[model samples]
Target: MSKEDPKTNSGYERTLTNAHIQLIALGGTIGTGLFLGVGNSIHQAGPSVILIYIIVGIFLYFLMRALGELVLSDLHKHTYIEFIEKYLGKNIGFITGYLYWISWISLGMAEMTALGIYFQYWFPHLPTWVPGLITIVILLFINLLSARLFGNLEFSFAIIKIVTIIAFVFLIAYLLVTGGKTSFGPVGFGNLAKNGGFFATGANGFLGGFQMVIFSFVGVELIGLTAAEAQNPKVTIRKAINELPLRIILFYVMAILAILLVIPWNKIATTSSPFVQALGATGIRNAGSIINFVVISAAVSSTNSFLYSAGRLIFSVTYDGKGKWNETFGHLHRQLPQNGLILSACLMGLAPLVIILIGNQAFNFISSTSTSMFLIIWCLMILTHLSYRKQTPANKLTDFQMPQYPWLDYLTLAFFGLMIILLLSLPANRMAMISAILIFIILWAVSKIWHQERAI
Candidate 1:
């Protein structure tokens, strides 16, 4: 493929339709975090968990808007790394790119691990590593073969997730109206405050739930990464970002409200999936199996998204001359970065075996480390946008200016900082924070060396 070839030079297939893009975003953001982690969040915030999701949704909306604005103004076939490089200097871009790559790689591992756990429900005889390995191989092949295939697979996964959540909402409503085994008698809006009243756990509870709520919103920005591949980048990007708030409200807020109303918040289990437990509480015997399937789909979607993201992040770094632009890896075959895809698959497949060897506790530690790193990446992105705005001449800002300019960007950065402080203050998260800081320092040093070498 010639550098000038319209198809290959564009770096990805413009094969992702608006539906595919929206579904992929939905699949990517609404994952096990909502299905499984919500219980713990509810435990922390009680009914106020609803407010936590809303607050995070608002911030995430602003973040996506900033990203959409940036991508539209510079219509290069560029990834987020390219944006960082263009706006924050090459060194910073290089560091941010690699950090993101590592972050997603680790996240892919975490998703696979969760998949293995979910699979264990039906196939107790099967070792967790077996399913984990199989998932990695299948997704890797799909991603490597064609970008369109991956998009289609993700689209299907997204549909299953969306439909399931919607069904769950309806089921909860129906059960609440019909009454359950216990003489709950038409579980209504009163459930929101009946047990302990709204803010049942108080202000500290809301603050504690914020971290997990933010985690649920982790992959919402994935649409920005897919911009270079969207069939209509400009239109799709705007629609996807703009619809983020509604998606959060429908999927996270309303869904949780349904769960709490159907099953008392105090009764929600922290270890098991809230969805499953909530349904079971309503005397739905097969609820566990049903939720398992939904969660498995959610995990697969997350792994697929992470795999796609990992490949692009690595490819973007290569394009910027930070890594070898392996002809095989960066080249688009059937509108896919084949080598990058294969590499990501192999790494994810290997992660489970490596984790098993180290034990479950070690795997959990690594997962926490990855989450912390992602928070850092988010902070860097917001800061990079702030710097981009300041350095960009006022006259040039018309094309893609961040709304409220420095103020919104600054506010987002501050929130990110506060989250980091929370992470550091929490004893369990301290190790992850230290690890992330060390990784950042190492990347910063490497960037310095790379620049010096290039200057010579």
Candidate 2:
């Protein structure tokens, strides 16, 4: 209905509908994390990983509902970045926006690096940099187009992911029904606990799985970003966020359950894609290769979404009058943040180069930091909701409201707090958590210095 940026004169049209927002959120949440990272998570936590997904999914549901309420409370506002500045302070808003931008850039790098690794599965001699660079270039080209183009690409990617998961599940179901056997053994649901109990990995191992589990859901909140582009924020975001629980169950919970039914948890390969390994184990022809193709598609879709969001997020933050870089990065060209998109693409491309130069460990380290930073961002979203509730009177008008207000908000915060503590318990995430804190402190200090000078 509207075709103008809420805070700027630039006429950015709201062309996205409910379907675009729904599928984009699906594509964002179901990325390399489910396809690649879950293999390692299963190796660490055994069948209990299902519980981890459910737990995180539930908390995020509440978080998204809270965000939905905030967005719909004022249909004219495009993004929560501005809400932070309006309700909180300019400094918090500035820091949160930039941190989110940085997180997506890091995530884009991780997805691209995964793309290269997936490619190498076929051609052992192909350098990792080749696919990563090619992918970055391809996604950059796509993301530089109109916002509708980005939404359409995401919808296509979501379709590919849905088809692959359904195929995997049905294939496994058929094998189980027909009493199929492979080198591993007979297909049956007993595989879930056959190797060891559900918590076979012990309490520490189960807790350790939360880091990867939470990381897998990194892009779940991307739906909030899409609110600005929706044809109707109140209707579109509500429908999208309301369906999150079912989407999580279908995509994460049941899909993993299918994999476990076909093969023992311990038998699943930690280093390779578990879906590929499980199918190949069941004597499916070219199963691993076929699944690798799907994974490649998933990685590409994810990187494309992240690059698109990163650019828009930067534009959203800087376009506000108080932003430090408002002069040049403040506006859009041709209804798109062309300059911001180019800048983010260049920075994102560098991550793949780092992977090429430093090896897989670099990818792992940066990816961990990205996850940790995103966790902080999630916490901030909940905190912002808390602030919104506090500042607004009970009688304030809201087209959509998060059910079980204050309590749900409080529980969401507690869940995130526990996740941070669990994150610190693992050596893999400790450094990344430390790095996130350091970045925040540095940003706060710099923002304070700049503010005082401007005031003087």
Best by lDDT: 2
Q: Which ten residues in a row have the lowest lDDT in candidate 2?
A: 1-10
* Per-candidate TM-score against the hidden true structure: 0.91, 0.95
lDDT of 1 at 450: 81
Clashing pairs in 2: none
| Candidate 1 per-residue lDDT over residues 1-456, each given as its tens digit | 222324425556566778888888777778867876687789888899998888888888878777777777665645877888877788888898889888888778877777766776788777767777888888887787777788899999889889988998998777667764423335677778777888998877777776667667777888988877777776777878878888998999989998887777888876567777766666667877888888888888888899999988777777624335545455556666667777777887777666668655544555667768878888878877777677877777645456887788888878878878887876766788889989999999998998888788
Residue pairs in clash, model 1: none
Show model 1 residue runs off by greater than 4 Å: 1-10, 181-191, 194-197, 200-204, 320-331, 357-367, 393-401
Q: How high is the CA lDDT of each candidate model?
A: 0.77, 0.82
The TM-score leader among the candidates is 2
Task: Please give the lDDT score at residue 270 for candidate 2.
Answer: 57
